[model samples]
Target: MFAFVMRRLAVAIPTLLLLIVFSFILMHLAPGGPFSLERELPPQVLANLNAKYGLDDPLWLQIWNYLTGIVLHFDFGPSFVYPDRSVNDLIAAGFPVTLTYGTLRARFKTR
Candidate 1:
């Protein structure tokens, strides 16, 4: 049982890391960013905002920082539009609802 669990964990860790990397790539490749605005901001303001969010860093550095942040802090960082809330907060709030729905779905499907 111990060896089985360890093997599963070995696979799970790389799978999760790959998932994060793919998500990061897709997010960055998307047309607009979390900070996109319909109206243009001044150049200085835009640059400042990018720097503030570490968007000015090289892509590799950004990816490294993002992975390290999650590993060390278990944080998904703040919401893009909703600056007041973190991703973890949203997940916690929604988990109960999702859990109930999933349980119901599975229960009905097994019938």
Candidate 2:
């Protein structure tokens, strides 16, 4: 049993490393800055927004900031393009709906 668990951990570590490396590479492959949506804003407002989110830094640095944010801050940040609610709040609210859907799906899928 111990050997089985140890083997699983050994396999998982490489998978995690590959996922992180792929995420790093894929992030660079994507187009434009994160603030691409707010381009219509005045320069000063854009600066302020970037500063508020720490987006003024390099991409690697921003990724570090966001990863640290998820680890330490427990703040998932707002839902992108969703004006009415925060991302964390939206997830909290939607969880029940998702659970209900899953239950219904399971009930129907087995039929």
Candidate 3:
């Protein structure tokens, strides 16, 4: 059973890495960026925003940095939509509500 679990994990780890890389590539390939708006921002402001988020880096470098951050620190980085909060913060904030709903559903289902 241990060996079976190890074998499954070996396959699953690479599969998950591929999934993350592909998703990152696909998101970068899409047209408009997070800073895109109906009213055009000045070039200096746009450049500053890109620099702040490391968006000015090459795609490969960005991917390397992101992967390293996740692997080394287990961080999902910041939230693009909510600049003041991080991805982890958003998840943490919503987790309690999710847990409450799940617990209630499971309790009711078993009755």
Which candidate, 1 or 3, would have the higher lDDT against the true structure?
3
lDDT against true structure, model 1:
0.89
Please, what are the lDDT tens digits per residue for candidate 3 over residues 76-101?
A: 89898899999989989999999999
Q: Regarding lDDT, does 1 or 2 come out ahead?
A: 1
TM-score each candidate: 0.83, 0.63, 0.86
Off by over 4 Å in 2: 1-29, 32-39
- How many residue pairs clash in each candidate at the backbone level? 0, 0, 0
Measured on C-alpha atoms, candidate 2 has an lDDT of: 0.75
lDDT of 1 by residue, 28-64 (tens): 9999666666777778988888898889999999999
Decreasing lDDT order of the candidates: 3, 1, 2
In order, what lDDT does every prediction score? 0.89, 0.75, 0.92
Best by TM-score: 3
Residue lDDT tens for model 2, 4-108: 999999999778657765886686688865567655777897798778766688877867766666657866675656756777898889999999999999989
Runs in model 1 deviating more than 4 A are: none
